[model samples]
Target: MSLYMLPLAIGPWQIALIVVIVLLLFGGKKIPELMRGLGSGIKEFKDASKEEDKDEKAKKE
Candidate 1:
């Protein structure tokens, strides 16, 4: 099984609780702002991963 699927990890209820807590902490007013930042971070991470893949391919050529 994948490490991500290991037992004792969060289930649906825990995930729901976490989301609720985050909403409460950041508030509905600011969740979108936080999400925007998160989206940018994810984009940057994906871009970096792709760049690394390209560099590895170039090195093997």
Candidate 2:
């Protein structure tokens, strides 16, 4: 199989455009709520992984 390369260059304008689009789609009021939910989800995932690691260590010992 052959590998395809992606464009590695992204400038400030591209980032600004993406931010603007997100704001437009989510609107000003909803972005904070979405971010809060996203943060909690990520935290929950990390906590679960840590718990799993502790369980594995306990089993091995």
Local distance difference test, each candidate? 0.93, 0.91
lDDT of 2: 0.91
The segments of candidate 2 whose C-alpha lies over 4 angstroms from its true place after superposition are 1-9
Off by over 4 Å in 1: 1-8
**Which candidate's lDDT is highest?**
1
Largest TM-score belongs to which candidate?
Answer: 2
Task: For model 2, name the residue pairs that clash.
Answer: none
- Deviation in angstroms for 21 in model 2? 0.5
Compared with the true structure, what per-residue lDDT tens digits does model 2 show for residues 3-36?
3433546689999998999999999999999999
TM-score of 1: 0.70
State every prediction's TM-score relative to the real structure. Answer: 0.70, 0.81
Report the lDDT tens digits of candidate 1 across residue range 1-61.
7886787577899999999999888899999998899999999999999999999999999
Clash number for model 1?
0
Q: Report the error of model 2 at residue 39, Å.
A: 0.3
